[model samples]
Target: MQAQRKMRIAHYGRKPVKIYGKTTQIDSSLMANTTQEEKRCSFITLNSDPLYVAYHDEEWGVLVHDDKMLFELLVLTSAKVGMDWTSILRKRHDFRAAFARFDTKIVANFTERQIASVATNCNLDLKKV
Candidate 1:
């Protein structure tokens, strides 16, 4: 059996339209015009900070099923306790560098000396797991 095709919306200009039948269907007259207010009110607001807002909008709330990503978030969130997220966010690069990039197999093998070294650093507030 063949899978059924789903109808999709296409944008001729600014408006979302669905082409149906022999005649091209214009979904609405509103597509030709858009106001700044309308744009701002869109589901995903584009008017945001390039760095912080982009990460928040794209990756912040998105679900993660990958083990590496899960471990990274875990380490980051744990390291962030009693501290501001901004500080943790800023030091994320350093954390990756120091922690071997959250490789589960590698971090799982960390010795007490390794954990102690990372915890003593001014940049990281590592906790012994």
Candidate 2:
């Protein structure tokens, strides 16, 4: 005798979706029918913070061709070691201003006093600075 498998239905704003065992099977047509607001990536959907959502949609995974912008991304990624991306992005403006908009030459010229000032103003970790 074979055991009968139970199926479940889940609602997702537009329609009732069928769930079978451990997997969910969605129709290709259903995906096409979903609105833009309903078609976001899982991470963005999970967080839903406006700034984070915008970053995911606009910046995350996009290639950077500008030298200064690449430097900015490198600095921000380094700063994210012990922190969450949300907090890092929240302070992005402060970081930009403090780091001379991530201009490589200008930042290389920052003196000890300037570094300390930027660190204090941006509340950045000294070791990371």
Candidate 3:
């Protein structure tokens, strides 16, 4: 049997879709008959994963400038050693909260106490890195 296929947009509020098979564009007439509920459900599913879909659509694999931001991404990527990127992405806010907005200077100065605190916070998983 063929594997079940599903597609999702990388970002919320948008419907950039990808198909697993060769079906390119369905007929407009056919789509016209698709229920609004179905369309909405499909869109929601695309953006409903554990991570922020908008970030994938907007940032993943895209070239980033800004040395500070680049450094931040690098740190997070390294922190993701054995974990999924989506998990890290979902906890981005928690990281920012703990690390003081990814300010290199601030993070660099983090005390041992701060490090210990973050290690226990369930919102983020930083032990691997």
List the global CA lDDT of all models.
0.59, 0.70, 0.58
Order of the predicted models by TM-score, top scorer first: 2, 1, 3
Residues 1-129, model 2: lDDT tens digits: 011110111122233334455554544443444454554555567547899888876677554679999999988887787888989999999999999999999999999999889878877787864
TM-score, predicted candidate 2 vs. hidden true structure = 0.66
Worst 10 residues of 1 by lDDT: 1-10
Predictions: Cα RMSD each: 11.1, 11.1, 8.8
Better of 1 and 3 by TM-score: 1
Question: Which of the numbered candidates is closest to the native, going by highest lDDT?
Answer: 2
Query: Which parts of model 2 are misplaced by more than 4 Å?
Result: 1-39
Candidate 3, residues 42-124, lDDT tens digits: the string is 33464466354555445664445687788779777876777777788877777677777778888789888888886677344
Candidate 1 lDDT tens digits, 1-129: 011111111221232233453544544543435443332313334554345444554466544678988988888888878886667777888878768888989988989998877776634544423
Q: Candidate 1 regions off by >4 Å?
A: 1-50, 122-129
Task: Tell me which residue pairs clash in candidate 3.
Answer: 10-53, 11-53, 11-54
